[model samples]
Target chain A: MKLSIIGVGLIGGSIALKLKEKKIVDFVCGIDNSQDNLNEALALNIIDEKADLEDGIKNSDVIIIAIPVDATRKILPKVLDLMSDSQTVMDVGSTKAGIVESVKNHARRSRFVAFHPMWGTENNGPKSAIAESFSGKAGVICNREESAQDAIKMVETIVESLDMHTIFMNAEAHDLHTAYISHISHITSYALANTVLEKEKEEDTIFQLASSGFSSTVRLAKSHPEMWVPIFKQNKENVLDVLNEHISQLKKFKSALEKENFEYLGELIENANKIRGILDK
Target chain B: MKLSIIGVGLIGGSIALKLKEKKIVDFVCGIDNSQDNLNEALALNIIDEKADLEDGIKNSDVIIIAIPVDATRKILPKVLDLMSDSQTVMDVGSTKAGIVESVKNHARRSRFVAFHPMWGTENNGPKSAIAESFSGKAGVICNREESAQDAIKMVETIVESLDMHTIFMNAEAHDLHTAYISHISHITSYALANTVLEKEKEEDTIFQLASSGFSSTVRLAKSHPEMWVPIFKQNKENVLDVLNEHISQLKKFKSALEKENFEYLGELIENANKIRGILDK
Candidate 1:
């Protein structure tokens, strides 16, 4: 099978490399706006051929849209317009509602699958891609019924080849759940980083006294704004809902401390400990 | 030298194991309110012998107090009361101001050192003790001027034996800095966990969609409240100060999202990205 990975960045390059490693896809055409990224992907052997959008879309049997959500919304219609009925198109965007709605009325809508592989790191670009990045993670396919059976099968095959389990859900539900599980975490990390940066004037002290816990909590602050901004923009209402809940949750902690209510503080922490059951680690 | 580790759980057991491994202390007497912990420590070779608090303090030349901050504040003066002029006592509490102030006017105040090893995990108990847990981490000694020269030297030597670099600062400043870098991170983590648990009622969905980013941010929520509540109580004012700053920072993100101010959101994230330069990873 031949695959075309648009954007040729972290997630795109990772999926391409994993499919090639599994010998499920023989050729990968890299399509990216940045020539430097294309060269880096090609030099790193993340793709077999670097092609322009037209060539990349026409030559491959499967096309994956792996870019910022805003960019994906703008280009999905164009990507669908250029694809033949036999070719399959899938997205790896963090937000699914806007992308699915963008091409809902297109003639080739049946060829596009709204898919999101639930895996990423603070790093980016082709250099950060790993063949094992998606292994054991969830591959969420939203609005699966909207796509043709052949397109769904193709995307599922790619997800399986990458060693991820499949999860089917509606586009709206996916956005809502992701806002809670994924998007709010990023906001907390960024705000936490900004908090330390705002309160702690001594950079050397922060660098020296930073424990493993501090680093782990703030690690997601290093994620790219270009990618995350679009996600917050597209999922604005849901993200705002969770953000409000998160702030109110923080206020409870503040109130506990101000009141010196040790009993209430302990209860709050014990309740948060309930997450241990939900998270594997 | 003979050593005593009061409250032989995670931090205390870890110190005993490492000192024994490095041959810095020949004997370790474990003291704890829980007999089961002492037995587990002895079974794991984390301690050589189990002793009551009186015997543990009187027999050893050095005493290391590692317990909840509230417990440490209550027991530190008594431990110092049992020690001779040649003996030294040090604490491994997260907050320094309260612990140091607890015994400020004691006759043997100079023999007690305020020390904190900047390393920990969500897990606890003797089973969680590792000899190398403090390696490459900071060992902070607050109010060095208040500690006797010999006591300071002994704690510094133990820090070196544990393969950690020593940092010296005043007690008040240490509490302030830790509130920004460490205490606030825990609050943010617990709050983030509670937000998700409160909002996302579907546990299975969270388990499936929890990304590496989400897990990293909320990992500290698994920390034992027995340990954290006291730290927050001791450093309540500083923690509250930073927590307020953190809430305002988060409100900025919320406002930006609500108003669709992508530029401000981008700036917030870019500012947060500065932390990448501070953290080694």
Candidate 2:
């Protein structure tokens, strides 16, 4: 099988490397807006060749879109229009509702599958790609019923070859679930980094005194704005709802501290500890 | 030298285990209000024997207080009252200002050293103790001038033996700095965990969709409330100030998303990304 990957950055490059390692694809062609990334992907051997989107889709049996959500919304319909009837197309963006809605009425809608691989690092670019990055992580297929059975099966086979657990959900539920679990974490981290950077003017002290906990909490702050801004924009309502809840929770802590209510504070912490049962398992 | 640990929990037990592993002290004694903790410490060989507070202080050349910050405030002066002229008393509490001020007027003030080791995990109890916990973390000795030269030197030697870097600061500075870097992270995490818990009703979905990023951001929510409540209470003013700043930062993101200010949101994320330079170093 031949695979064509668009926007060959961290997620795209990683999938390419893993599929090549597993021998699931005999050839992988790259389509990227940045020539430097294409050059890096080639030098790093992530793809067999760099081709135009039209040529890449025509030549490949499957096409995977791995760009930012806003770009995927803009590019998904165009790829579907250029695809042959038998070729399968999938996207691995963070948010799904907007992209899925954008192509809901395309003539070749049956050939498209919306997917999100639930794995990433703070680092980005082709250089950060690893062959085992997606293994053991969830891969969600949204609106799977809308796609052709053959297209859905092909994407499932790809997900399995990458060693990811597969789950199926509609686009709306997928967007909401990710907003609660994934998107809010980035917002919390970014705000935390800004809070420390704003209040602690002494950069040297923060560097010296930061513990493993602080480092881990703030690690997601390093994620690229170019990639995340589109996500927050596309998933604005869901992100906003969760953000309001998060702020309300912070205010409760502030009120308890102001009133010297250590007992109440302890109760809040104990309640939060319940997450251990869900996350640590 | 002889060593006595007042509370045989995670911090105390870890210190005891490390000290005993290095043979830095001739004998180590354990003192705790809970008999089960004492028994566990003995079974784990974290202490040479279990003793009453009076006997532990009298028999040991150095007594270490490793309890919650509020308890440290109540127990610090009493421990100083029982100390001999040549003996040293120290604490490993998270907050320093309140603990230091509590014993400022004691007759044995010079015998007491206010220390805060900048290391921890979500786990607790004697069984959670490990020998290498404090290595390479900062150990801050607050109000070093108040302690006798010999007492400060003794604690410094122990710190060095544990392979930790030592920094000296006043109690007020220590409390404020910790509120900004360490304390706020825990509050953010607990609030984040609760926010998700309240909003996402589907536990199975949350369990499946939680990425490594989400897990890392919320890991501190698992910390024991018995350990953190006192720190938040003792450093209430500083914690409030940082909490207000953190809330303000979150509000900015919300307003940006509400107004469709993608440019402003991008700018905020870019600013937050600056933390990578400090934390990754």
Candidate 3:
């Protein structure tokens, strides 16, 4: 397989490295707007060569879009328009509904697969790519019925080569579930980090006391705004719904504390501990 | 030094293991309300022997209270009443103000040192005790001036033996700082886990989508409420203040999302990212 990856950043670079590691792709072509990123990807040997979109499309068996969701939404239709019958296009965008909807009416829609490999870190760029980035994680394929059987199979093959479990769901359900499980986590982390940063002026103190569960809870706060802002913008309604629920939960905790209702607070924490059964599996 | 550890659970058990590994304690006697925990501690070699609270105190030169904050508040004075001038008492409770105040008027008040080791995990019991648990973490000693120099030196030496950096603050300041840096993190994580569990009915989906980030963000939700509830109850006012601030921050993000104000959301995230400077240090 010849794989062409757009963006050439964390997700794209990771997929390229993983595919090359698995010997699933004979050649990888990177198409990135940032020449510096392309240069870094080349220096890291993440891709065999660099090419423009047209040249990348003409030369590759598969094209993977791994840019921010808003950018992916804008460029997906053009990429779909340029797809050939034998070539398949897949996306690794965090938000699927907007990107899937953007190309819904394209004539070559069946040649495109809407995918979200459920893996990422706060770190970014080609330098942060890992061959095992997607290993043991889920890869969501939204609106699988919309894609042709061959295109779906090709994307599934890629997901399998990356050692990911495949999950098929509608675009709406995909966005909603991710907002509950993934997107809300980032929002909570960011808000928690800002809360500490805002209230606690002692930087050295936070550094010293970070190990007491603060570090992991705030780890996602370091995520790049360039990646997450577009996700929040594209999945506004779903993110808003979850964020509202999260705020209400925080308020419930606050009120319990205010009323000195230790029993109620304990019950809330006990209820929350139920996630252990699900997450530990 | 001889050591007696009350409540041979996660915190207590871990301290015993690390002290034994470092050969800082010639012997560690275990005392807990639960016979099963005491038996497990003995069987796991986390403690040298089992003793009642009175027996443990009489036989050891130093007593370490590693119980929940509420339990610590109730038992601290009793332990202090039994202490000899040559003996010292230290606590590893998450909240300090309540525990410190509980023994403030005791005749042997100067014999007690209030300490909070800035380390923990979701796991519990003797089997979960680890030798390297406190390494590279901060150890806070509250109201250091209240304890005698010998008592303070003994606790600080124990902290150093565990390879932790010592931080000294008054009881009020210790409680307040922990509320911001540690206690609120657990609340956020528990609420986050509960939020996802309440909204997303599909447990299988959460299991499949448990990315490294999601797993870490919700890790503290797996924490036993038995350990956390008393901390929240004891540190009610400070935890409430930080929780309210955290809720307000979450509301800001929610409002931004509801208003489709991507720019504001981006700014919030960028501001949150400033935590990297403090945490990565």
Q: Write the per-residue lDDT of candidate 3 for residues B10-40, one digit (tens) a residue.
A: 8899899988888888899999989999999
Identify the superior model by lDDT, candidate 1 or candidate 2.
1
In model 1, the runs with Cα more than 4 Å from the true position are none
What's the lDDT for candidate 3?
Answer: 0.90
Q: What's model 1's lDDT at A30?
A: 93
Instruction: Pick out the ten consecutive residues of candidate 2 chain B with the lowest summed lDDT.
Output: B19-28
lDDT of 1 by residue, A1-281 (tens): 99999999999999999999999999999999999999999999999898999999999999998999999999999999998999999999999999999998999999999999999999899999999999999999999889999999998999999999999999999999999999999999999999999999899999999999999999999999999999999999999999999999999999999998999999999999999988964
Candidate maximizing lDDT: 1
Segments of candidate 2 deviating more than 4 angstroms: none
Q: Rank the candidates by TM-score, best first.
A: 1, 3, 2
In candidate 2, what are the lDDT values of residues A120-185, reduced to their tens digit?
A: 989989999998998999999999889999999999999999999999999999989999999999
TM-score of chain A of each: 0.99, 0.99, 0.98
CAPRI-style class, candidate 3: high
Give residue A162's error in model 2 in angstroms. Answer: 2.3
TM accuracy, model 1: 0.98
Error of 2 at B235 (Å): 0.5
